[model samples]
Target: MTSQNSRQTLIIPALGGLYARLNDGVETLLRVIAGGFLAVHGSGKIVDPFGASEMVEGLGFYPGAFWSPLLAATEFFGGILIALGLLTRPAAFAGMIVLLVTVWFHWVTMGQGFSGAEKSLLWAAALAFFVVRGGNRHSIDARLGKAF
Candidate 1:
């Protein structure tokens, strides 16, 4: 049987060692970027939390007033939590749900299909990763020695 070291070397002999050393940092970077972009994307909604009421209602979310603000908070505050790696799993799960809704909205509601829902699809996948992995050693969860 091929040892782990040999398998890694066989894949990329030259950069394998570098990749191993930077794997955690790279994971941290992915988390930060994903969370940061999510926060930025929701920043506008946060300012006018109720502005999406009509949109939410259109998606069959009743009482646009409540759902709109909830969506805003889930995107804005949840993104912050994910970025900080605090409550990472819950935050990511929330974000994933939001992204999935967008996917449906674009793909089925708007009839844009794959071309329109592509970004939401990718974002959902990324959040799914965090939902499963939580934060890494560089995260606040790690520093606090506790994670949820």
Candidate 2:
């Protein structure tokens, strides 16, 4: 066999063994972190609608009041999805949009880049991973599939 075929022969099994453990470890960690971040941020907005309104206005999203509710729900509800690993891709995409708006509010309008996109970036990447992986191996999607 050629080198490509030989490489695949050796690689497939090794990848199978290694990827599960690796994905499980990373996904669990990311899910927890993403959930926590959303919960905290959403709670803040829910608790302080006025402050959130000001933020929405600053971001120029129109109807600042409406922005508050949408943002709060996105973070809070999306966080729950992230926690459950259900609809994680959409949730992550929503979350990414939220963060981009926030970043734009702070970085573009306010002229700063200090909020640290690291966690948001990480969460977005992890969510994208799940989107591609389809919550494979250990997820509600998989469980439901097996159950049905």
**Which of the numbered candidates is closest to the native, going by highest TM-score?**
1
**Candidate with the greatest lDDT versus the true structure:** 1
lDDT of 2 by residue, 1-148 (tens): 3356445655457665565457576766667577667867788776766567776876777788888888888888877777676776677677778876655555557666656554555555665565565444455656666311
TM-scores for all candidates? Answer: 0.93, 0.71
lDDT computed for candidate 1: 0.92
Q: Model 2: which ten-residue window has the lowest total lDDT? A: 1-10
* Pairs of residues clashing in candidate 1: none
lDDT over C-alpha atoms for residue 58 of model 1: 96
Model 1 weakest lDDT span, ten residues long:
1-10
Give Cα-based local distance difference scores for all models: 0.92, 0.67
Candidate 1 runs further than 4 Å off: 1-9
